[model samples]
Target: MKTINFTQMKDGTKEEYDFLAEMEKPYLSLTVDRVLTELKNQGEDSLSGYKITRLEHGLQSATRAYRDGADIDWVVGTLLHDVGDGLAPQNHDRFSAEVIRPFVRQEVAWVVEHHGIFQMYFYGHHYGWDKNAREEFKDHPCYQSCADFCERWDQSSFDPEYDFETLDFFTPMVRDVFSRKAYDPKVIKENQVFGLPEPIFHKLS
Candidate 1:
């Protein structure tokens, strides 16, 4: 009863499959812990040439979003948007998006999935790549949201001197996000474009 008796996919009984599902609940519940651990690991090493560590970059991005009056989904999505960079540098945006897609709004996930291309507007030209490559998604509802996310949070977050919140400050928000029922349509809000709030600091400035 402790383990599924069958090695082959076609051989498992319903009782064994149910047992496995039951066993997975604890692991699934610890998603937030695993994510937090990865974020902490990001702080242990700096990406070459960047003035700040990846963890700091994420903290800055989340702080900006939180200050902008973004909801929990937006703030958490922005925080983990680069989590995939450690393992999948080539297409980290999409990979990061998948990591949160099940528990967040569809609009937020879409922005995360495409933020990489949208970000090219900032530095792709230095290497002779098309800076406007993101134009291909101009018609998508979340395009502007993604652009703003990159401009306001992602691209502007490398400053070492910026006062960013610590990972502990965002731990509750992260736990709240990951605790949601996975893929709940009520939570996903497909095609709903809750775009970024006007920058709070902009008004102050």
Candidate 2:
């Protein structure tokens, strides 16, 4: 493939920028494959010594959400809610939230972002933290939703014998979600309510 010749962004022609944007689409597609590979790799170990691998826990969470008639965003969010553990264990929820924020509803992203604190309601006491630590954000609109996510999907997902579906079963959904534009103008506009730059809409369009 012919590459742009300009060493500096200010020297690039419109044609070069256009070519780069078009090339980005294929690279975006590759990101989905890479994410899937990473998810599979996460199965090699149990989280915090849990019996099931993180992959199985993810599958179990997604399976439960699927059986409960959750939407694609919800199921996919459950599957990836902890995919950042390997790279961002101390603040995995934030990294995971950003990964799916572009592809999912804001509500789903909020649940993923705050699931760690919500999860503490179940076991934080073991680490000398308040079990009700999540209460600190009781006034947030998505508080109940995140609470439900931890209660029904995340905290309960460590079952080793559950008939959870395989990662293959959710592969198509993963591809479909990531295939969407990473920054839809409409979504960006809505996200402005949360402090994302309004100028991003023009930049994307």
Candidate 3:
């Protein structure tokens, strides 16, 4: 299996860890911490009646895609793609888009936006494919981007939001809405992860 590692920084001193060699994977420290903060607030179950937490779903979705043979970067993007949902529906996609834009290729950011397929269907499409959705979506720069990205989506598994209260995945990951927490200053340092470009948090604060 492929191996991953990390090096902690302490006052300009770096300490490295061979995670795979040590039987660990440390790629998602601060990245995941931020994602978890969002999950902690999602508070729901999946559409299949299974306990699919939003936070967990994002993590699991990434895992599912990976198991299905996606690359490492896609895995990370899928996992934290919806990190913005923890903020607000409209705002989250933009926030996540920015966060992932610099680090990944535009495609990754597109995936992050389309994770909210409902948003795409409603705002971007016209009951048809992207060609039909383009005009409406073109109204907003980000929404237009989502249209192109969503064109190649996997639609076999249906996601119904109407039953969200009863649908686990639609349910929030956390029971109560978490107070909008201030993001860490360190996030700025991640601006160049090669997936997400700008500070996705721009939509939040």
Candidate 4:
């Protein structure tokens, strides 16, 4: 069956739905490729006025996570945390979270989803917004995790001079991540809060 025979979802037959699901497998298998392409596009076009490109920022974040001995999920999550900015600037954090939710741990997704609010602690006061806005999530299991993510990886990644890894260096890691079984309970580890690894300090010359 090349296509479904129904004009509307309400009229689709079981056989047709099954066929569609089977057809989706090939597209699903290439998810990592699409993600990588989008990340490269971010290097070409992203929000202006930053010291580095959006792709550079993500690479720096992931480089930091990997150098700190974070697991693959943490490193990839940091790499793609801002991916949705090009298409969903208004709430890119949540959008980016959804992009990785099926593959990474729940704790990582939670941090990505809420990092926007948590990040306000750095510059919101300059605009008269409540810098403490993230305090509302203080009772949640991943609150501190999100706070630490913003402080270490997200907010601190804008320096153009930082020696970040190239996209090629992280492509294999990205493939390893998105290739996982989607939403596997063992992979998600719901509500688990293995917070960010301690920074790996490098002495200045």
Candidate lDDT values, in order:
0.92, 0.82, 0.44, 0.93
- Can you write out model 3's per-residue Cα lDDT over 73-125, one digit (the tens) per residue? 45556555666765665677667766655555445555576556534454444
TM of each candidate vs. truth: 0.97, 0.85, 0.42, 0.97
**Regions more than 4 Å wrong, model 3:** 1-32, 43-51, 114-131, 134-205
Q: How would you encode candidate 1's per-residue C-alpha lDDT over 40-81 as one tens digit per residue?
A: 989985478788999999999999999889999999999999
Q: How far is candidate 4 from the true structure (C-alpha RMSD, Å)?
A: 1.1
Pairs clashing within candidate 1: none
List the candidate numbers ranked by TM-score, top first. 4, 1, 2, 3
C-alpha-based local distance difference test score of model 1 = 0.92
Question: Which model, 1 or 3, shows the larger TM-score?
Answer: 1
Provide C-alpha RMSD values for all models, in order. Answer: 1.6, 9.3, 14.7, 1.1
Q: Identify the runs in model 2 with alpha carbons over 4 angstroms from their true place.
A: 45-48, 185-205
In angstroms, the error of model 1 at 181 is 0.4
